[model samples]
Structures are given as C-alpha cells and as structure tokens.
Target: MNLFHFSEENGIEVFVPRVKENRKNMPPVVWAIDDVHAFTFYFPRDCPRIVYTRTNEMSDEDHEKFFGLTSSDIIVTVETDWYERIKRTTLYRYKMPSDTFQLFDACAGYYISPQTIIPQEVEPLTDLLNRLMLLNIEVRFTPNLHPLRNAILNSTINDFGMHRFANAKGN
Candidate 1:
C-alpha cells in the first residue's frame, strides 16, 4: 500500500516498494501518523493516496476525508519514493516526551555498546536476559552504532523521518 506521510513543510510524500509495483506487496497494514488524524491502520487496498495539504491549502472535501478517517481505519493501495533516504545502518523508534526518548537511547546504548560503558546487567530471572543476549550477539554482526550516539543532538532527517543521509556504495 502507499505510504502517506504528511508534514506542513514537506506537504505529503508517498512511498511504496518499487520491486513489486503493487499494493499487495506492501505491508498488510500501516499506521500513518500525522497531525490531521490518527489512522490505526487496516484500511482497504483501494483507499485514496492524496497528498495531505495545509489546513488552508486543502479543499473542503479533502479536509473532510482526512479528518473523517478514524484511528481504526485501514489503508489499501501504496506507491512513492524515499527508500534511498532512510537510515540503512540503524533503525530507530520514537515516542512522545523527550525524557523517555533519552532513557530509551541510554538503555539501548548501555546494553548494546561493545565498549561496555555501563556495568549493570539484567537479572537472569527477567526476559531481558535472553533478549539482551540476542541483541549482544546481533551487535557483533552489525555496524558500530557509536556514530549515531549523538545523533538526536543533531538530526539529519526531516519531520517525517527522511533525507539522503549517505550515498549508495557503487553510485
């Protein structure tokens, strides 16, 4: 399905996998977050792909359609670009409130960093033991995340989480 991301500065940027060139190849469901409305994902495949516009720039019908979309609404069709812009090396998830973000970052770093900066470890009784073990092993095969340590202090992405953070190797 088409990935619809809306932002005041960028307007609306749509994205879909180029390989399949079909909505069926896209995720069965998507959670599109924007200030306009909250769509909890699972809309039909034939849902529209309109570029979200500013409150004033949007037409009355378009505004009604967007605002009418409820949290449980599901989207169906998808297409667009920006796969080249997402960070390939490190994946990130963000939640509200800056303090929680900082804490999550620190926890992730302490548990995954090779430097062993943090001496604390999750107890064997907890589920984190296995997850941490897997994560620790995963880190060995993954690129160093140190470069992104200070990333939040200096973001390279737009409000929609995009940008050409790096060039392709063989380009």
Candidate 2:
C-alpha cells in the first residue's frame, strides 16, 4: 500500500503521491469507483451517426486509413481543453474545405451551453456524480474481493465462531 489518503471537512478525499515511491511529478486527476465496475462512457449528442477517433498522427495506421495522409506530410500544432486532460494528446486540425469533422471551428455551426463543462476550481467527481444521478447513469464493474469489500460484507465483526483463514496456497 503506497497510497496515503486525507479528507477535508467537506468530505472531499485527496490522494497525493507516496514520497517513498519517487512519484513527485504525477499531476493529480481525481478518480472514484464505488466498485471496480465503475467507468465513464462518452456519448455523441443529437445525430444518429457516431464519430470515432480524430487525430493528426499522419504516421499512425488508423489516422492514415481515415485520412489520405503520408508519414512524410508536414504536421500542424495541437490544442487541448482547459482540463489539460486528453488521451494521446497531440494533433490540432488544419482548415480544409473538404474536412467536415473538425468540430470546434465556425463552420460546424454549433453553439455550446454555458454549463457544458464544470469549472476547474470545483471538486471533481463528487458533485458531478450527484448531478449524474438524475440522468440514471449506471457505472458498475465486475465484482471482486478485497479487504475493504470483505470488511463490508462481513461487517458485523462479532467473531462468534471465527476461524483463521489461509490464502489459496495454504499460507
């Protein structure tokens, strides 16, 4: 167990790096899972059509398949969101008459809601989860056994007829 946990008066739990592990550079990203099954799913709004990976990685096979680009092509600079979080974070689009998928530009003709994103100053997962309750989003994972889950299931702790248990290899 290399993690240390602390909670403020507001019940927001914070996880910082373990000093002994030499993990000082890890930028914090809040995460929560009531059970292992919990995860997030991204949805595309309105249109029945689904949009997949958008990238400017000219060298990548997937990107090359979708776009007629070669590895030797000159690449452009990339931009990212305020949260500073994105997977494989590289690639900003170049304005082209034939391109219809570069979503953030003026030609897309979409207006965003003022409340589309949560302010960065607010605590992350806790409040967003409360709001998600109204939408009935079910986040779950396959059940697994751990000390905390075991303690929850056997919460009584009466030990009326408790016997020592051993690991699978008969420890």
Regions more than 4 Å wrong, model 2? 1-101, 104-125, 144-171
TM-score of each: 0.16, 0.15
lDDT of 2 by residue, 97-170 (tens): 21111222232222122121222222223332233234443312222213323432343322111111121111
Q: List the lowest-lDDT window of 10 residues for candidate 2.
A: 41-50
lDDT of model number 1: 0.23
Clashing pairs in 2: 37-140, 37-141
- Error (Å) of candidate 2 at residue 65 is 34
lDDT of each: 0.23, 0.23
Q: Candidate 2 at residue 156, lDDT?
A: 31
For model 2, the local distance difference test gives 0.23
